[model samples]
Target: MKTLIDYLNAIPVEARDSFAARCGTSFDYLRQVGYGNRACTERLAINLERESGRELVCELLCPDADWAFIRAAPPPGRRRGRARNRTT
Candidate 1:
């Protein structure tokens, strides 16, 4: 499967900054995630997936989660109870 680093490296250098900004994160943070130095948060993964036009899929970004099931489920009206925390 293609990784975030692979996508990052594949894109043009000049576009990196703007892409990162559009993903609501710094290029440095993306670099860290790409290099496996930092964990990619679910929100950031979703943002990257959307901003990258699905180039950086959340399945690859957050491997631990069951993305297929999540996608199959209906959208929640309001989240209940404490948020499920993930360990980076």
Candidate 2:
């Protein structure tokens, strides 16, 4: 089976750099993880999932983590900007 590191390394380098920047992780660190020099942390996984909308945290950190509990947690605050109030 393909490992997570393999999957991460498969991404284009430019996009990986951008994703690392958005997740507040250094590109070097990401490369290290991809190379299997360092293990991925749950916190980092969570941050990545938050920024990229990928559920890698559950897939990597907590393979058995219940999706219902994950969904029950409070949603992240507005990542782009202030919420827009709309009237219909």
Candidate 3:
């Protein structure tokens, strides 16, 4: 099976730097995460997804979490609650 690092490394060299920049990370840092030397955080996963259009969060980061619930959750620093009442 191809590891995440393998997949990442397979991308064209010319595009690698752009991917890293778009993810707001360096290739070295991403390589470390792919190698399991560093933990994959949700924020980073979201960035990667946004930049690459690949949802690696479940496969890489929160594999044990309920992804369905995660998908239902609001964005960062936000919550699901009732709206305010209108003044009469």
Q: Which candidate tops TM-score? A: 1
TM-score, structure 2 vs. true? 0.51
Compared with the true structure, what per-residue lDDT tens digits does model 2 show for residues 1-88?
A: 3445655677687788787888678878976765768766766667766765563444564355565666667667634557788999
Model 3: lDDT of residue 32 = 90
User: Model 1: per-residue lDDT, tens digit, 22-86?
Assistant: 98989989999999999988889899999988877999898887889888776777465677889
Please list the residue runs of candidate 2 whose C-alpha ends up more than 4 Å from where it truly belongs after superposition.
62-88
Itemize residue pairs with steric clashes in candidate 1: none
Against the true structure, what is each candidate's TM-score?
A: 0.77, 0.51, 0.65
Flag regions of model 3 displaced more than 4 Å: 1-3, 64-66, 74-88
Predicted structure with the largest lDDT when compared to the true one: 1
Q: Model 3, 1-88: lDDT tens per residue?
A: 3455876888799899888888788888889989889877777777876665564444455355466877898998876897677899
The candidate with the higher TM-score, 2 or 3, is: 3
Each candidate's lDDT (Cα)? 0.87, 0.66, 0.73
lDDT of 3: 0.73
Pairing residues by index, what is the TM-score of model 3?
0.65
